[model samples]
Target: MEREKIISDVRSKAGGCFQKGEFYCSEAVIHTLNEFLSWPFDRSIVRLAAGFPVGIGRSGCVCGAISGGVMALGMVYGRDPGNAMDSRMFPVAAELHDHIKKLYKSTCCRVITKDLVFNSPERKAHCVKITGEVAAWVADKLLNDEALKDKIQPVVV
Candidate 1:
């Protein structure tokens, strides 16, 4: 598949998941990446992102979509226990952080959705858009960068 189409599919799927209320911001991002990467970790890995939605479980800190993007990057660049850390991890994560910050002007959920009422359609729409955008951005990085792309070990079988 072409990289553009793959990125588009990822964006659509992540947004669709959030729009359907099947998952929150972080969950949608992580879920879409897992599926796209052929479950490099495992379906259960999504649990790690569950509490990140609503900004660290409604504490209203970092944007959940951004948080999920970081995790998605980690899935590719993170190192195993007792193994040498991948030099690319922090730089990639920082790039994602900067990307989200550049788009929204802040990585905080409270700041991003402050104008919309909680649980309102406006807020949902905003979150859904970011979820898709973040997922697509991460997909672009993963697919385009040879080092990152090589890290994805598609499940065989």
Candidate 2:
């Protein structure tokens, strides 16, 4: 499916961004890309997002979108579990994270905006864009990175 179509599908869904009344554009984009580039998108993002406003954000971990995007990236480029955190996933995810941070200026939700989590529609919209930009950045990065790009291709089925 086209990237926009996938984003539209996620938007129309009951809980992603529109339904949550948030303006997380990057989140929306990342979600869309996840669906387009990976199998079973919801299963991955939802699980990563679960701890977002609930545990991760309150605890000051990586932004949910970053975590979610990395999850997708790892699903594609991740190594076996034995190495875990220090594997290639970290460098790839870290590069993506740095890129996202540079693009957005900051990764903290509160820094991005002062609104409460999942409360303000405007904040959600902002998040959607942030996530979307991150997704696009990752996609572009992957496309340009020869070793990574060589691993994925248009599905034949």
Candidate 3:
């Protein structure tokens, strides 16, 4: 299927944020990249959400969408320097983070949902939902039409 559709499906089905196995939802993003851009799944997603859940206004640290977007960007443009001089990931990460920040201020879980309490299962479920929605939306946007690339983004993304 199309990339955006995949993300949307993930968002709808997964219900919310990262719930251990929820990485399965991330699989959609990975599969979309592989099909459309020939990108690898594992490394791409790890890099994408590197500082995510934490950053995603969940008191965790970073936004999952920013992390996921950065991962997608890396899949599209990442290059291993064979050493430690590579800086490509950081800039792309920053760009994605900026994009997400613009969409949702603070990029903190507390900021996104004021009542979130990490210790509660229900709260965790809510956080997961938010993460899924954001990740899918961001992934959909980045996967938009480019002639060379695939068309993915819909109104939600």
- What C-alpha lDDT values do all the predictions have? 0.86, 0.53, 0.51
Greater lDDT among 1 and 2 belongs to: 1
Whole-model alpha-carbon lDDT for candidate 2? 0.53
Clashing pairs in 1: none
| lDDT sort, best first | 1, 2, 3
Best by TM-score: 1
Error of 1 at 94 (Å): 0.8
| Model 1: CA > 4 A from native | 147-157
* Worst 10-residue lDDT window, candidate 3: 148-157
Kindly report the root-mean-square deviation of model 3 from the true structure over all alpha carbons.
6.0
lDDT tens digits, residue span 1-157, model 1? 5667778888888899889988999999998898878787788888999999999999999999999999988887788999998898899889988988898999999999999999999999999999999999988888877755655433211
Compare candidates 2 and 3 on lDDT and give the better one: 2
